[model samples]
Target: MGTIVKQNKQLYKAISENKRFSLAIFICFMAILKIQYSNVESTEYLGIADTKEININSSHSVKIRNIHVIPGQTVEEDELLMELERPDLDLRIYELESQLNELKAENSFNSEMNKELKSVKVSNNENMDSPLQIKINSMTKQLIILKRKKADLFVFSKRAGVIGSINVKVGEDASPFTPLITMHDSAPSMIKGFIHESIYNKTYKGQKVVVTSISDPNKIMDAVVASVGNRIVEYPVRLRKSEASVTYGREVVIFVSKDNPFLIGEKVQIKSFEKPNEIMTAHAQAVPVRKIEDVIDLEIGVDIENTKVEPSGLVYIKDLNQTVMISDDTGRKDRPYIYTVNNSGLIDKEIEIEGVKAISDMEAISMDENGIIYIASSMSEKKNGKVSDKRKKLLMIERNDFNFKAIGEVNFYDALNKVAKSNKSEEWAQVLLAKGNKKIRINIEGILVKENTMYFGLRSGSKLTKDQFVLLKINDIKSVFAKNAIDADQISIQANVAFPIDSDFKNEGVSDIALINGELYVLTVNNTGKEGGRVLKTVLADPSNHMTELKRFKGLKPEGITYDTSASKFLISFDQGDKKSKLLLVDKF
Candidate 1:
């Protein structure tokens, strides 16, 4: 009986041991399964703190006639903050109305005549004249005039919002096409932020975002990604604030949802995830506090799945161990280089420059010899060619040898006609003539001649000799033949005469000719102490015939003229009394 009892106890013990073993195996398998699932789901997401901004003003430009509201003033919707006056446009409209009235009167008369002919059953030449037609024409003319007048009185609401700026005053003549006032729209606010083009692919719409207003510290606004633009430059991001939220970029709109109101044009803090809620694994130091570009001298580990963060620095990653941070040892000007530890636990490799940033730390995109990395500096340098002094000034005439001399005394009328003909082609000549003659004896005679011609010369010579006849018509005379003379048949000619025109004179004496937009422009100023200035334009073919005075601005005793080819305009700087210089831009003609 004892042996049987002992055998039963042993069987029970064996059964209990088997059950405990099975439980232990099951728990071990579950633990392995949990670790595998965690590994598959685990990920690290790089996040950046973005500022939410609002653009209060609709247009990029504005002309202020008056600033009705101050910077801190709170404004309501559709409020009249300022007024704009367009005087020139008003006059133009009145002229158009008058012409419309005449056309309408003529049309009314024709309609009445046609109606009368239709009413009359009998068609006859004697009944052609209809009194009704005359009355109908007059009424039609009046209606046409009224319609034309209505078209001229045009006005635009600068913009629909609170007034931000008013630059002009009442009774002041505002230049056309200039802005008068700026308006800020309170509704539909957006946030503006700049991101690199490399990381743009990772960002998408419908991503959840937490926005905290800068002006109202306690308010947290919930929003989502709106629309993204196709342009790659530093772009503006707009966040459609929830209802009752204040505008972000402007100063007039305010929100009362939180304890404090959100100021217009104020920046707000924002946090968003690039992907759906995933197990994020990131070091406390890896996440940038301000912006990714602002970080420097920090090591980072990133996942291998996220290609955007591949090779890392403002990129997306999938696994942590695949990425390793290294020290940046490359010089600033040289290629950006990074030192990485090898399998032997020694720093063995260096990387070249990969990219760069303005707001962020410099990124090494490539490398060079000696395992050095090159990073792009923040400044952008450009090279340009130097301008030669010879090209700045225009050349009028080449050096040449020419002479002029008169054979005998010429009459006042004849001399004057010769001078005018010589200046026909924009060229002037030096006139030379004999002034007086000296008698050596009955057989020999000597003569003295004056050769240079002044800009303004009198026909009558105040200084001349009695016996020496002044000849003004001589075009050329040989030096050998006129060395010394006297034969009754050979007339004594004047000597060589030359006058050099100074083309280098800039102020008060320089004149310029320009061809702009297929029109000839002649700029001339009277440096003779006359306050006269003229700007003329004409066809190149017939400059003298159809010369039109485009601009007759009178101010400076004019001196020099220059035309800027790039601007397609001319500038005339005048010396107004006391060395004060005035520059006028001639745009038309």
Candidate 2:
């Protein structure tokens, strides 16, 4: 029995120790939770403190005149602040009125003696002497003098307030534009302050503000934003009476409530209450995928006669918030898929994907409802070959039977050397060859090369060519060929006519040909073989007599000419230096 009792005591003690340990752990956990809760509560409220002072004086200057109110005297609204003096202006008005009175007396005497004049004579006499016929000239002159004198004694009150300073003595001479005294209004006034442009958008007019007076720490005023400055001014408050040297802040005026009586020139702490900026939210499907070069060509599924097909990698969106899920895994092999929202508002996930069509090397493809895809212009990196291949396959093609071929290549230096060997003037030959080599490719189709003469066709089927043909040496011949030619489209000229030379041909011959304004214009290049080639126009009516040089255009190279019938303009390609090209539009010819 003794041994059993001892065992029971040890078991009881072990159970009691375990219970105490558990209670201690629970208390520690509760304490930690309480600390966390306190931290979260602190974040809910935020406060700031600023230094402020009262401003008794302002920087604005005012003119004072009427001495009816003495210093420290209370005044009402519209009460006189001061009057501006204008002695010089009054004397000038009196002198002018005296000269007018003498002229009127002389005119009156002439009118009384002109009673027997004829109609023409009377009209002539009135034009010559009509100024001296006034009777009240003396009284009118006196009245004008008195009005001028009255203006000199006028009184003005520096905007409604109490007179603070009296700089002008009663007998002191005051200038018209000089300040006489200082006036200030101390009635429950507002604390005018400014905020910077960086924080201007965060604040709005009529927002509630708390103004804490600096002179009286316990004095707090409730105010609202009264006005916002239309213009942004540089810091260093020139208008305020403070001497602080900080620059770069904004000015704001806060109207104090009648309940808060703050003294003028008293600096106050202003805490403005501003609403948080609003953020926009949109469905993930509304985001578009665009290419860096072209955003218009995003793959979009279109309905063609009840069948859906992708076209030009471009999609037109009829509505937003609705999306079609296209399967895309960013080239990952892990079951490439997409989630699409259908017309029924059901989200479909894990849909099989073909490929992500891209607009260019830099943009990705995104889709919306109706299976329409858009181009995402801003992408982190260029798309891989998978996206490029898909986009190429989706581009639309027009069914036309036009064939193009590259005939031959001309080395610029070799061509220039050959021209120099045949022509005695190497300088002129070099200049002409240099200008021609700067061009990418010169295509002369529908050109007839017979014996030593060549005829250029302005159109595909035009029988007539330009009347004049430039004489060329064997070296001037750069590979000749015929393209888009038919047996009936050959050029056969019967007679030779005299070529008319216009003023434009004095510098250089026509380098390129294009049809404009129902006439043919020959593009001329400047003597220098610069990157930007000049252009000139030639009218081709009779082809023999109507060859006149028109105007020259700088920074334009005529290459690959095509007439746009829809726009009625000529699309000329300008070789923009580095393998790149620009299209120049000429609507007027």
Candidate 3:
């Protein structure tokens, strides 16, 4: 009877332990849920806002008389920031006015002489039509223009801001091209975020917000809206959720503490304390990351007039153990030439391309197994929106006895237009070709030819789709060079595969693309002041449009990329504006 009692006690103790363990697990699960909810509640919509840099420029060439404000000094609008003087300009004005008065007096004398001659019935046609009258009129206009220069002698503050720098001193000549002083606002550092039109009514002056750094969410501060824009403006390309589509929003300036630690031009997020999830998200949910493990920098040894060549395309030659590169800019003194660079990044030889006058914006180069070479142009509009005929060409050349000769060449712009029309997709192609709402200009930066197929990578996403990076594919591209294929439809569009990401920023585009071991690789670059480059890889057979980012780099404007078998790695060539072009050997990604 005693033994049975003990067994019952032990069973009851085990049950109690099990209950305790279960309760502990339940508490942990609830804690995890609470943490996740807290994160979601704190999430904010992304935007870019920074302190505005205002430049104080010289209206004309003038000598600085005095500087009233020092660096980091605060001043009001219309206040004196600097004083300028120009004795040379004053003397020129005096000279012009004196010339004008003399011409007028000479004209009056000629008129009097003509009147006397007429009264005496003597022929006076020469005096009446004398050139003195014309000279007087011209001088008077010139004197008036010269006198206007006096206004620039006394420079005033353009706005109420803080002085950033004093570029000129007393007696120093300042030109219109260089700013005499740089200034920024004195107001507490604020964020200039864009809110959609739909949420415009929800936002108002004095609305409370939680500001967070896009790069670091841990850095957060409480802020309030200072002002709301009266009219809606288009969102910037980098802040837009869909770069291929147009979006409008009202600019909202949120004032944060003066001691806030946000850098200028750094992108941040602004969230209202209430209704955090009510507004539309402007930027992507994921932040940009640099995936490159290490970057190897190399300098170009050759120089052109003390400036290095701007390399735009690269291709590896296995037999020569060297790489062939092309420059986008060539002088009129010489024809476009392909440069051969050794492993040490020194130019070994220059092979001039025959039958080609000049190349503009030569972006990509590829070579086939049979020693045939192909070079592609950018085919995009310039900043002024005009397309260059020289940049819209594609050339094919062959090497025989170390001499390169042109085999075939075509205007790729017209060819693309014809193919679009034949496919009954001209409407979509027009959007890609032009610049307007929901349109991205065609900027082909990368080209690769494999067997009978050719692929072209667009710097901006194609207009055919709204959210995918596009590649223009053509079948039998080489058949156009055949004797009978001149009038044939050998260049019909075959397909356009899409990449997953469309985060396009201003001046950001695909720098290059390469086909290695039947896999396609893309390199995206940003030439602006922010963001570096991203390398992405994906297979052509990826029906689901899966893309994997392999590497990222900064401080280099990568313009060309190629796979080198000898090194078993990838080489990227950079176009350093005004500086020498550089070569980067990337570690295996």
Candidate 4:
């Protein structure tokens, strides 16, 4: 009976130990749940916010007198950025005015002389005897030009933003063609993220989310959903540090708190729930998330049936949230025009330019911060034996109250050719020209202005490669504008690459280039073959790597590319190659 009692006690002890073990395991399991899949925390969508840069370029070659704002200072729109010392400009204006006044006095004397002569039938026809009046009209036009030149001397900030860089100082000469500074928009930095498809429904616009630094756990912040993408996209490797070999997900764009102390390009974690708006911060929280400003919805990409622009390109005007597309349509009768449109693809107004500036086969277009539009004219031709004008020039235009007028133009032909030859493109170009008895025209397919530099994508290739190999050359816009020739020291050739990210990719040359927040995107096309077109993305920070194909764009021969920040999509135009040109929008951009 004693033995039986001892065995019962042992059994009870074993049961007690088992219960303790079971309780400990349950505690650990619950702790892991709180850490990993907490309803309040999610690591699915993660990214960092970055501010966009606005380049401010000088428009005239003049001596600067005073610099108003220093680096890191915020400036209002139209604020005086710098003052120019132009005694010569003032003297020229005065001289023109003096000439005008003298001509007016002479005209008054001539009128009296003509009246007396007409009474006697000596000078009956004023049209034949109005040399003085012609001189007076000429002087008046000269005076107007001198006054406009004087106005260009006083430079102003194009938009309200924080000055990030200052390349020119007081008492120095600044040229209109070169960038003098760059500014960061006054708006807060933005984070573009991607969410796993499994939890994408838990993410949405206006949803409240927490952003925690992956590098520093104590650095916590908040963000609000600005946009949630509609389609699944390839996960950008830069957005996360993942071990997964294959990655695809939906995207979300968030506006980080204005006061958030996160560095640009740094990775962070984002946690979101179903009811995003309900999770907004309560009153006592430090660094409250700023309400996202209502970004004007510029209804972009909804194509209007009869609007076709060939060899086309368009740029976004951020200050006004407007879009301007200039056509290179060389008509047999009239000059080409610029098309300004509203959000609904309705052509608002048309501005006609002179025939000479709007030359035939003007392929590429870009814009500056001062609202100046630059259109590239490919005037070079292969003649009987030599290259005629072997260069490209720019047509400059600026907006007036209701229309746009050709402000001025500066030659960029010598600059572009010099850069191309320096990059070793000249010899191979000659070989292509020699391949056939017929004259082969070399043309620039696209142009992009990024900060202080210009990227030109050439359509014709060298060494009998034609479209198989593309020649890309970049010019320091400042040096190109400051001097008529591209600085030989500043030219760099982009590496020729065939995007092989997809299994069925073809060797299409680059047709266009667009830089978004320092990340470069290229439009590639194999127009002669089955590979129609595609857009590729390359991280500027890691340029040595091959460009990763972003999306296969089946649009009709898309030849030009630009990004519309307000719409958050890439806008492209087709050459249509003798057909009606069309515009295509890529929402997955």
Best by TM-score: 3
The TM-score ranking, best first, is: 3, 4, 2, 1
Which candidate comes out best when scored by lDDT?
A: 3
Q: Kindly give the stretch of ten consecutive residues in candidate 3 with the minimal lDDT sum.
A: 281-290
Taking all chains together, the TM-score of candidate 3 against the true structure is 0.45
Q: Per-residue alpha-carbon lDDT of model 4 for 1-589, expressed as tens digits? A: 9999999999999999999999999999999977753434334567765666767765556776887889989887679988776777788888878878887877777667757775555453564357776777767878887787687677787556789898888788876666777888554466778887777777766566777778987777655566689998888777645756557778887765345667767687887644323343423132332222211212212112123445456676776566666665644422556655443333344455632433555667777666666777654454663343413456666765445666555466554544454444344334333244233345566676666566666655434343343434545565554456655556555544445545444556666666666787777777454537777777553444766667675535666667678877666665655565555555664
| Candidate 3 segments exceeding 4 Å error | 1-308, 332-334, 421-441, 461-468, 482-508, 527-531
Of candidates 3 and 2, the better by lDDT: 3
- Model 1 TM: 0.27
Give the Cα lDDT of each candidate: 0.33, 0.37, 0.67, 0.61
* Alpha-carbon RMSD, candidate 2: 31.3
- Tens digits of per-residue lDDT, candidate 3, 1-589, equal 9999999999999999999999999999999978745534422456665665767776567788888989988887679877787787888988888777787787777667757675565345655455775576677777766766676567787446789899888888877668888988654356888888777776676455667788987766655566689999998888887889888988887655445767666788887634344322223242222123334333332222112467888888776667888887754433467787644454545577876766677888888767788998888878896667788778889876557778878777766655554444443455454433333357778888888667777765345443345566666777655422322244333235444454543355567888777787777776344547777787765523567778666766778888778867687787777766677666567
**lDDT of candidate model 2 versus the reference:** 0.37
Error of 1 at 292 (Å): 31
Candidate 3 clashing pairs, residues 3+ apart or interchain: none
Sort by lDDT, best first. 3, 4, 2, 1
lDDT of 2 by residue, 1-589 (tens): 9999999999999999999999999999999978744422100111122112212211223233346666666666446544544454556567666776666655655555555444535675454534443334554656665675555355544234566666676645654445455555545445567666566554455444566665665776444454567777665454334657554445676654323556656566666533232111111111222221221211111101111111101111223322322221222222222332222112211232232222222112222222223221111112341212222211111111111112322232223234343552442333233234331111121122223223332111111224333322221122321211112112232212323444433333233444444554444433334433334443433444445544444544332233444445444433333332334434553
